[model samples]
Target: MDGTFDREHHLIAAAHHLAKALESTTDLNHDTKWLLSDLSAHLSRAIELGKAHRAHNSSTAEIEARLMSAAQTITRLHSNHPKIWDAGHTTISEYLKAVAEVQRLTLSLEDMDLPKTSRELLDRAQNTLHSAMARLEDELAHALIRSKQGFLEHTEYEDSLVSNEDDSVRTGRFSSSESDVGYETDLVHPDSIPHIKSIAGLMFGSGYGREFCWVFTGFWRNVLAEHVAATLGFEQLSIEDVLRMEWELMNSRIRKWRAAVRGIIGTHLVAMKRLFDLVLGKYGDPITSSACLVEASRAPVMRLLNFGLAVSIGPHRPEWLFCLLDMYETLTGLQPEIDALFPDETGPSIRADFHDLLMRLGDSAMAIYRELENHISLCSSTTPLASGGVHPITKYVMNYVTFFVDYGETLERLFRAQDAGPGPNIPDHLRSLTSALEANLNWKSNLYNDRPLKHVFMMNNIHYMVRKVRESPVEQQFGDEWVKAHIGKFRHHATCYERETWGPVLDLLRDDRRVGKSGQKGMCRAFAAAFEGVYKRQTRWWVPDLQLREELKIKATKMVIHAYRDFLGRAGSSVCEKHVKYSEHELGTYILDLLEGSPKSI
Candidate 1:
C-alpha cells in the first residue's frame, strides 16, 4: 500500500474511509492530533531523504548514506511508506520526468562512447544516479501522502470551528444529576441521556459521525470554491488533490454532527420565521420598541416544527410525506384552552403573539400555495417526479393546516371577553378582525369559489381554530373584521376586469357550467385576485396592456379569459354579467384601493 492513489479509484476509496471514520468515532480532536503530528514528521523526513539521495547521484558511497536515511525514516514509521506502490509519484510527475531526463543523459554518456578515465567516471555516476533516482522517487511518493494527511488534519481543525452551530434543545424530560445521597434521586433514563448530552453534543453531536459530515461538507465546499476560483484564473490547490482529500475524510468520518445540528438550526429558523409571521399579524408592522415583546422561548412545538422541516423540506429533502406526519403529530397533542387568535396557552401552549402571526401567515401561505402549486403543475406537466404541483402545495399547506383551522380561530373566541370587556389598549385593527369573523363564521381563503374544488378545498382547512373563529360571536372575532376588510379590498380590485374590461372572464368562472361545474360563486369571488395581479402595476387604460387590446396580455388576463369563455360556452351571458354584481364595482374597488394604497384613507 504505497501511499499514492491508484489515480483511477484512490480518491473515492479515501473519501469513503474518511467518511467511515467520521461516522464511527465519537471524537478525534484529542486522540487524532498526535497521529497527524507524527504523520507530518515522517513525511518531512521522507522529503528530506529524497532530496539528499537526488543530490548524491555521482557516487555510490554518498548515495548509500542518503538511502540509509530514507530507510530509517520508513522504519521509524513502523512500515515502508506507500511510496513503493506509488513508486513513480511526485509534484507534477517530477519523479518520472527526472528519471527520463537522467536515463537519456546517461545513455548519451555510455562507457563505450567515451575516453578510459572519463568512461570510468561516467560509469560510476550513471550507476549511482539510477539507484539514487529510484530511492528518491520512492521517498517523494511517500512524502506526498504524508503531506496530504497533514492537510486532512488541518481541515478537520478548521471544520470543528465553523461546522454549523447547533443550538442544542433539551426536549425530553429533564433528570437530576445526583446519585441519591438521600432516599430518592431522579434517575436519568437511557433514552433521555442522549438528549441531555453536553450542550455541544446535544446541539451538534460530538460523535465521529456528526463531525465527519460537517468536516466533509466544509472541505468539499472549499475545494469546489477553489475550483471556481481556478476557473477565473487564480492559482490554488488542484481539484484532484482536494477531491482526493475529501474522499479520504469521508471514508474515515461519517459526520454525526449533521443530523443533530440540522435538527437544531432548522428549529431556530422555523421559530424565528413563525415569530416574524405572528408579528405581521398583530402589529401589521412592528416598530423597533414594541416588537421586542415577541420573544422566542424555544418552545417544544418550535423545536418539533424545525426538526420536521429539516427532515422534510430543508436539509435532506426526503421523498416521504412528512408534512402530513407533522400535522398528525401536532393534532394528537391538542389541548382545550388554546385561543387561536390570542393563542397564549398558560402551559406549553403556542405563544399568543406567535400564534396570531402564524394564523395570518397561514392565510397568506394559502395564497402562495395556490400560486406555487399552479406554477409547478404548469412547469412540470409531463414529468414523473412532477407529482407536479403536489410537492409545493404540501410544503406550506400541510405543515401549517393546524395554524389556520384550529389554532387561529380558537384563540379569537376564548379571548373575546377579555378583548372587548376591559382592555383600553386594544388596537382598531384587532377589533376589526374579530368583527369580520363573526359575520363569516366560515370565512376562508376560497369559501366562495365553485370550480376545481381544490381552490376552495386548497385552503378549506376549517377544522379546529379556523372553524371556531368564524363561528364565534362578533366581539370574539375582532381579527375577522380585519380579514373581511382585506377580502373586501381584494374584491373591489376585480373592477379592472369588469364587463367593460375583463367582465366576460369573471362571468365564466362564477355562473358558467363550463369546466363542467355548476356554481359560479367561486369564479365571482376570484375577481379580487385576478384584478389585483393585473392592475397592481398600473391601472390606467394606456398602461395595462389589457386596457388597450381587446385580447389579454398577461397571465391574469388569460385566466380571466379562460374562465369567461369556458363559462360563456356552457353557462351563458348572465354568468359574465354577475362579475359586476358583488358589492358594486365602485364599492369593491374602493375597498381594495383603501386596503392596499391607504387604510388610513378609509
Candidate 2:
C-alpha cells in the first residue's frame, strides 16, 4: 500500500512540472499550441484532484492531528490577542484562515460515513469551528463598538441640522433636501468592514448564522438607541407619559424627536443598512441582511414614531397643532425611504404603523384647525381695548394662521383629504377662519360704548389681518382677490370711521341761514365746544398701523379743514375773536395728530 501511494504521488508531481513547462513554451503552430495548452490544463487539473484525493484517503490519525494543530493555533491566537480582528490588526488574517480550514474539514466530514477515529476528528473540527465562531462574535461586537462614529453633540446637531425658527415655523418648514439632513461620516470605520464581513462569512458557513445575526443586530440596536438619546435628545415615551407630561417639556421633546427621526432615518439607519449589506450581504443572503437591518433599526425608529403617535392621539390643543403638523410632514416626506429600508415581513407592520400615525396626526391637526375656528367664534371680551387697536384673539389667530403659510402646500393637501364638503380648499378654510375671527371681533366691538370707536377698532383689526396675509406666503393660498376683498372691507370700515367721528364735527361748521347776525357768536361758541370736544376725544383714540393712521389723518384733515375754513369765513363777520379759537392750519395740524396711538388731551 505504501509503495502504491508513493508511485501515485511521484506521477502527479511529474505531470504538474511538465504542465508548467508546456504552459511557458511559445514556438509552436496554432493547432499544436492549442493541443499542448489543452493537455497542460488537463494535466494541472488531474494533479490537483490527485492531491485532494490523497488527502481525503489519508489516515484518520493524521487528519485528527491537523485539526488539533489548527484548533490550537486559533485558540492561542485568540487568547493571546482577543482583539486581533480589530480593524488595524494584521494577525486577524492568520486566525481567520485557520477557522476557515476547520470549517472546510468539518463540512467535508459531514458528507462522509466516518469511522470512529474519523468521527472523533470531525467532532474536534466542529468544536474548533464553534469556538472560533464564538470568538468571532465577540470580535464583531468589539469592532462595532470601537469603530462606531461618535454622535454629534445636541447643540451642534441643532446648529447644523435643526432650524432656529419657533416650533410653529420650524414644523412648517419640514421639507428637507437629502444633503441638508443625515451624517456625512460612515457609521463604522471603512477598514473594519472587511474583517467584519470575513468573520460573518465564516460564522454563517459554520451554521452560526443565527448567532451572528443576534450579535450584529443587538449591538446596532444599542448603538442606535444611544444615538437617539445622546445625540438627538429623544427618549422612548409611553402614551401615558406623553399625556401626563407638561406641554412645555413635551413640546421640547417633540422637537428633539423630530431631529432624532431625521437623523436616524436619513443618516444613521441608512448607513446601518449599507453596513449590513457590506458585512452580511454576500454570506447571509439578501433576506438575512434585510432582516437583520430591520431588527436593528425597528426599535429606535419606533421609539420616534411612537412619540408622534402619542401626540397624534393626545388632546388636540391648538398649541400642539403645529408640532403635530411638523411630525406629520416629516413622516410624509420620509415614507419612501422608510418603505425602501424595511421591506421584510416586519416592514409591512412598520409601514402600517407609520401610515396609521400619519393619518392620526392629520386627523389631529384637522381637529385642532377646526378647534381654532370654534375658539375664535366662541371668543368674547367683556372689556374693549380702549386704544381701539388689534384684539388679542385677532393677533393670536392671524399669527397662528400665518405660521400655516410655511405649511401651505402641506396643509392644502391635508385639508383636501380631511374636508368632506364639495370643493373644500385651503383658501376657504382660511377665509372661514378669518370670518370667525371677524365675527368674534364684531361681537367684541360692542363692548366699546362709543360707536365711532367701534368702527376704529374694526378698522384697526381688519387692517392688521390684511397686513398679516399680505406680508406672508398665505397671500398665495388666500389669493390676491381675497386680499383685495379684505382691503375693501378695511377701507369701508375707514369710511364709516370718518363718517361717525368727523362728520358730526363737520356738520357743526355748516353755514345755517336760520342763524341771525346776533346768533352767529353763539354758533361760533357751539363750534368751538364741538371742535375741542372732537379733538380731545378722538386724539386720545389709537390706530396702531402707521399707514392706516396716516391715511385716516389725511382724510380727516381734508374733511374738517375745508369745512372749518368755510364756516369761519361765513361766521367771522359776526363772531368775536374769542369764539374763533384758532386758524384753520392749527386745526389741520391737530387733525394730523389724531390716531397716533398716543393719547393727547387738548
Candidate 3:
C-alpha cells in the first residue's frame, strides 16, 4: 500500500507509530509523551478521513433532497402537534434552530446549482415550514378567543338538588311537582360562572380570592395590551384614536361582563332577594350567607369593573366623563339591596367594600380631568400669542367646567356616597381647578402692553365664564348666589375698561377756567386731537363678539358722550362756527361707531 490501507491495518500502523514517537521523546515524562503522541496521530487521521468523506460524498442534488425530506418531516410533525411544537416541548432553542435551518436551506437553494425538480421540492418544503409557523400563531389567537367565549357562555348553570336524609325519595330525586311549599318542590342552586368559580376555587385553595382577582385582571390586561399593540402596529396611535378604541373595547366588555355577572348571580332583587329568603328560612339570619357572598363577590367583581375603568382612562377621553359617573352609580347601586339583605351584621363590611369601589372609580374618573389640565397647561405654554383665538387652554378648561356643571348632581351623589359632609363638596374641587385656570388667564393677559386691551382680555374671559355658568347645567353647581357674584366681577372688568380706556378723552373734555381770548379754540383743537386719537386707536382693536362689543361700546359711549355733550354745549357758545368741529349728536354718533369700526377682537 502506498499510504492508505484497510481499517485494521490503519489502526495497527497508527498504534505502532504512536508507540515509536512516545519512545523518542525520552526528555518528557512517560505519561505526557504517550498522551501527546496518541493525540497527534488521532488528529492526523481525523483530517485525512474528513477530506476522503468530502471527496466521496453524495452530489449537491442528493444533499438538497435529504434536507428537503428532513424539513418535510418537521413540517408534518408540527402540523400534527402544533401546540406541542409551539409550546417548545423540545426546548425553544431547539425549535428555533430547526426553523433557522429550514430558512438557511431555502436561501442556500437560491444560490445552488440545482435542477428545476430539486429546487421545486425544496421550495415546497420551505413554504410548508412558513405555513406551519403562521398557522401555529393563528391557532393560538383563536384558542384564546375560544377560551374567553367559553368563559362567557358558561355563565349559566342547571340547578342541582341534594336530598336531606329525612326527605322522601320518589322516582326522581328532584321534581317540578308542588309539595308543601307553594312553588315547585325542587330547589336549585346557582350555577358556577367560570370567573366566579375561579375566585371560589382560589379561595378554597389559598384562603382568599384576592390573588385570583389580581391574576385574572392582570391576565386580561396583558392580553388587551398585546391586542392593542398588535392591532395598532409599531407606529404610534394618536391620543384620540387610542381613546376611542379604548372606550369602544371597554364599553363592549363591560356590558358583556355585567350580563355574565347578572346571569351568574341574578340582578340585585332577584339574586339577593332569593338569597335572603333562603338564608332566613335555613339559618334564621342572612349574616353568614351575606358574608360568604361578599367574600366571593367583592374582590373579583370589583376587580373586573375596575379593570375596565382603569383601562378606559388610559388615553383620558373626555366623553368618558358622564360614562364614568354612570359607572360609579352602577357600582354603588347595590347599597339598598345590601342593606335590606344583611342590615345588621354583614352590612358594614360589605358596604365598606362598595365605598372603596366608588372611591377608586371617582379617582380614576377625576384622573382624566387631571390629565386634561396637564395637556392644557402644556398647550398654553408652547402656543404662540400671535395665533390668537380663544386660547386652547381656555377652551379645554371651559369644556371641563361645563362637563362638571352638567353632571353636578351626579358628582354630588358620588361625593355623598363617599361620606363627604354638607358644605363645600365635590364642586369645591372643580372650583379650585377653575380658579387656577382664571389665574393663568390673568397671567396671559399681561402679554398685552395696552392697558385697556389687557382689561378687554380679562373682560372677555370673565364674561364667558359668567355666561356659561348662568346658562349651563353647571348653573346648579355654582348656585344663583355664586353666579351673581361672578356676574358682578364681569361688570367690574367692563366698567374698568370704560374708565381707563377713555380716560384721555374724558380729561380733554374737562373745562379749564384759566385761558381767555382764544381759549375755546385751543380747547376745541386739543379736544379734537385727543378724541381723534381715541377713535383711531379703538377702531384698530377689534371686538369679535358682536353682542359683548355692542354692550361695551354702549356703556363707554354713554359715559363719554354725556360728558362730551356738556363740554361741547359750553364751548359751542364761546367759540366761532369755524372752530367748533362736532355737534353733541355727531360726537355721540362717532362714539357709538367706534366699537363697530374696530378691528376684529380676540
Candidate number achieving the greatest lDDT relative to the actual structure: 2
Model 3: per-residue lDDT, tens digit, 297-340?
A: 54444444444444444555553554565445445554554455
Residues 1-602 of candidate 1: C-alpha lDDT, one tens digit per residue = 22342332345445545554554565677657566556555555655555554344444334334444433433333243344424333322443333344444454455233435456545554664445444443343333233321111101101211111221211111123111111121122233222122211211211122332233223323432332333223233233432344422421221222222222222222322333333222322333111222222233234333322322222111111122222222322222212321133322344443344333323332334224323323332222211111122222222222122323333343234235333222234334333333223222322423222222122222221233234434224336554465445423333332333445435435634444333554555565555554344223222111221222233344554465445446644565466433333333343233112111222
Per-residue C-alpha lDDT of model 2 across residues 122-164, encoded as one tens digit per residue: 7778878888888888888888888777754332122111222
Which residue runs of candidate 3 sit more than 4 Å off their true CA positions? Answer: 1-313, 317-364, 370-395, 405-424, 516-522, 540-551, 572-576, 596-602
Ranking by TM-score: 2, 3, 1
State in Å the error of residue 296, model 1: 50
Q: Estimate each model's TM-score.
A: 0.18, 0.75, 0.41
What lDDT would candidate 2 get against the real structure?
Answer: 0.76
Q: Which candidate gets the maximum TM-score versus the true structure?
A: 2
Error of 2 at 542 (Å): 3.2
**Model 3 residue 196 CA deviation in Å:** 32
Between prediction 2 and prediction 3, which has the larger TM-score?
Answer: 2
Error of 1 at 476 (Å): 28
Least lDDT summed over 10 consecutive residues: which range in candidate 2? Answer: 155-164
Off by over 4 Å in 2: 1-58, 86-89, 106-128, 150-171, 175-185, 231-234, 244-255, 283-286, 318-322, 369-375, 396-423, 472-485, 504-540, 558-593, 599-602
